[model samples]
Target chain A: MRRRTEPPGLTLAERKRQLVRDELGDAALRLLARQGFEETTVDQLAAAAGVSRRTFFRYFASKEDVVISFIGLVGEQIVAEVEARPAGEPPAVAIREAVKAVTVEDFTENREKSVALIRHTLQIPALRARFAERQDLLRDDIAEALARRQDLPEPTPRLHFAAGLGLLAFAGALKHWAEVDGHADPAAVLDAAFTEAGKAFAL
Target chain B: MRRRTEPPGLTLAERKRQLVRDELGDAALRLLARQGFEETTVDQLAAAAGVSRRTFFRYFASKEDVVISFIGLVGEQIVAEVEARPAGEPPAVAIREAVKAVTVEDFTENREKSVALIRHTLQIPALRARFAERQDLLRDDIAEALARRQDLPEPTPRLHFAAGLGLLAFAGALKHWAEVDGHADPAAVLDAAFTEAGKAFAL
Candidate 1:
């Protein structure tokens, strides 16, 4: 049950690069949420984050890549959270907790921001296409992490299935949360989704 | 259960239009499968289907739309199958049977064609983007059909969840089937995905 407060080891240069990337993500998300993704420009993103246009490119490939990198960061957190779970924890429980930990954090006070960002990501054709690809990669990452935690050399179908189900629950909850215009706590909605899935399967 | 052999009482003109559309879909799928989506031209598709190039636009909006229309046709069949299920069937079972009936028909002897079309659809950026949107619309359509069968005025969260899960299983099975280069029976793969979900949820 160890929690990662931060990565343990990083050179000063690496840490500085990580800081710049995080700053860009923060700025990009805020700008996109407030101004609409279609209208936002790379210059605006760079200016908002106090970085040059060249600096932004050094960190990310495009405006869309910034949002994707943000998602990738959360995915890495979920994997780390899963890896840090107790060895004896059930696979489902570990995945559930790991997903909840990362997602709930994203939706806390920044709930509306996250919702707007997600809406843009889903509604915009380019982002939506990338999102599907990201989901697949994230699912594999979760399954691989679960395999590692269980001391298995390779991920099994069962592990992949569990990862997929976890993602399904996450997606279902997000859909519900967005449908309600983010009025409900996403974490609570997620729990209900998991419960519904549990009940349906229990039969 | 009444299986619809054909839509009852189409005008001769309507039937003619339907035949032309189906012919185009068949030709488009075949050409796209063999020649690659990017390389295939509308002229070639029209020639193969024995139709004027202008008639292709009469039925579909674009090359990609032909593939989407093909998918939409199958989605309609899925909804119809779900609607036609006996009233006493459980929601999950009804959805499972409906999806299996329609999808299995699709993957039968035409397995390789399906595999190629699906691969092209997934691998091509424009098609992949549209596919994600199509999946969303199809989920709602399935849920609405389920709700109608249950005599509800609108679909419930449970029904939507059920629909989402069914699509998730279908997608997973498709992924597995494609991974094996279509060597496996898609229906059996789908059944395995559903069983795995049931086991995971039973916990």
Candidate 2:
């Protein structure tokens, strides 16, 4: 009624809640990269963000959860970009582009910091398991996006299978890059993985 | 000492030791299948096999470890059968055959029981994590076997990526079969998954 066009949905409380969550996530990431995951405590994370320890627990269960939620943004980008791809494009090519696009969009800033965060995340077995668990959620989003692009009634087994196959290649590429300490261009490694992926199937 | 042609290398003591382990594993499986994983106790398992609790811990670290070690046989069969596949076959076809072979060679004995075990395993978050942990080892073995068939000097990242892709399809097929309560021919479902896969790649 006041002629406000911005943020048409959120009430005053929801916006503040989101802002606090973001601040905590940013602080959590900074601490994780600098102090390492195991060394970074929740108290320290909250202190960095100017939030109470209780506030931290309200949003995240642990440092691992914060990191997962941070990178979960990339998963969202992948879905949005896949749906953004031309409908006429083949599902495989769309998937490949969608994966690549997430990096370009989400990782445009803090490239080195993001890499450091990821390196630290993978070194811890618990974090890696948490990350692997997150992938299923990503897989579902990818499958749903691919289905909409292909004009299917719903995400069929084929779309889900292809989505999984593509993500596996993406994961492999990430592993290869991470294993080598990221000396090479990770984007190129991912691109190659996508290109050379289905060659096993004579693609 | 009486010489035996069987197990040409293992000493009598070693042979007997291996026998007890297998017997314990069998008992554990029978108990786990009849009773739920959470409901079954190590003491009950040992009693079923007529072995001591000390003997149970002698082989497995925990109940979860026992189940992982049990299903781990399928992972080994996957590697062995993949390596045994004809070298001339495309890596995709070889992977498909290899996955199918594991089920036939291993699951033929107790298909329903195995499925129940898997369902229970998947339902329990901890068991699912442990099972997922075991899969990385299996993936490495698959990469190595595929490399051997492809005549690669080493398991290249590409081989690993392709192996992951193929496995992803196999997993999708398995999930489809499992979701339907294994009411259909699982192998056919897997076959269809593999066949329909890479159709996204313009195959």
Candidate 3:
């Protein structure tokens, strides 16, 4: 439901192509959640998004890729957000804010649908494997972001560990949030998880 | 390469069964590492271990299961080690010791074969997925271990976060160890990773 801005430098064709890609992703998530991930077909996704099957293929290689691509996009946004965080912030705080910027802001307005989609994604083995793969890349990107934020020459082991820990906290919080049917604000749960992690580490 | 004690309560037949299972796992790892995972078949594994194909099936459902069961056994042993840590040790230190007990002690004399098997496991998609799935269960078991150590009724969110963070550090350290061809002592790298994690969390 979050509307992403088309870059101002994009020409009409480029901007339209981006819009169509987003439409397909949106339709894919909805259909996958409603009809079930295993049951959803690529043709149905293309039809629902008002794009040709060929166009869908152009944007995404397969149905699994459609969902995986969305996750990849979110991961990239999270890394970008981390890089954009003010340099003075603590590493953990910056990482937390980066996650919050992408997930909390986007999901707050559509908690029910977000919860349904996340729950569905976790249930499918193919998606879970893909998610794990994306998570490995995401962790590395976060470590690099932390290094840049701290003005380090490159990511150190400590930075990588921090990145991994921060993401682990987020995952644990998200799992709990989804399990509870999103009754509590996702942001609050996430913050609490980070705070708990801080305490655990401090001990 | 690690030798496990048969539980004293087991009958002679049960002890023999356990030994045969261990033999198959050992043979599977050696064959999978030397010949490649996909290239190694069940018959080869059975032959290498001096067991019939039917007997191999009785012990393990498949070649992947042969590798995964070794991982599962290691995880269980780690949990048991955690339970056996000195009651007064700090939680992180205790968890670290638990890992050293299972991994450092077992792999020290067998570093080359361990590294080869680990590297191969990471390269195979099916094995990687199974590893991720096993990791999830392992994390939960670790959380339970932490909870029991602290006399908590159940695994708190903080406990789960700590378990995840601990495992993440181990994974990052192991990746580094294997990357460098295991020239450095695995325990030393693992310890440094945990120390770095401790510092990162404190920040």
Instruction: Name the best candidate (by lDDT).
Output: 3
DockQ-derived CAPRI band for the predicted complex in model 2: acceptable
Worst 10 residues of 3 chain B by lDDT: B1-10
> Which candidate's TM-score is highest?
3
| Candidate 3: pairs in clash | none
* Model 2: how far residue B112 lies from native, Å: 1.5
Each candidate's chain A: what TM-score?
Answer: 0.78, 0.80, 0.83
* DockQ score of the complex predicted as candidate 3: 0.41
Share of real interface contacts recovered by each model?
Answer: 0.19, 0.46, 0.53
Better of 1 and 3 by TM-score: 3
Q: What is the lDDT of candidate 3?
A: 0.81
1 against 2, candidate with superior DockQ = 2
Work out how many backbone clashes candidate 1 has. 0
Candidate 1: stretches off by over 4 Å: A1-35, A38-68, A122-130, A175-187, B1-69, B121-130, B177-187
Candidate 3, number of clashes: 0
Off by over 4 Å in 3: A1-66, A123-126, A151-153, B1-68, B86-88, B122-129
Give candidate 3's TM-score. Answer: 0.78
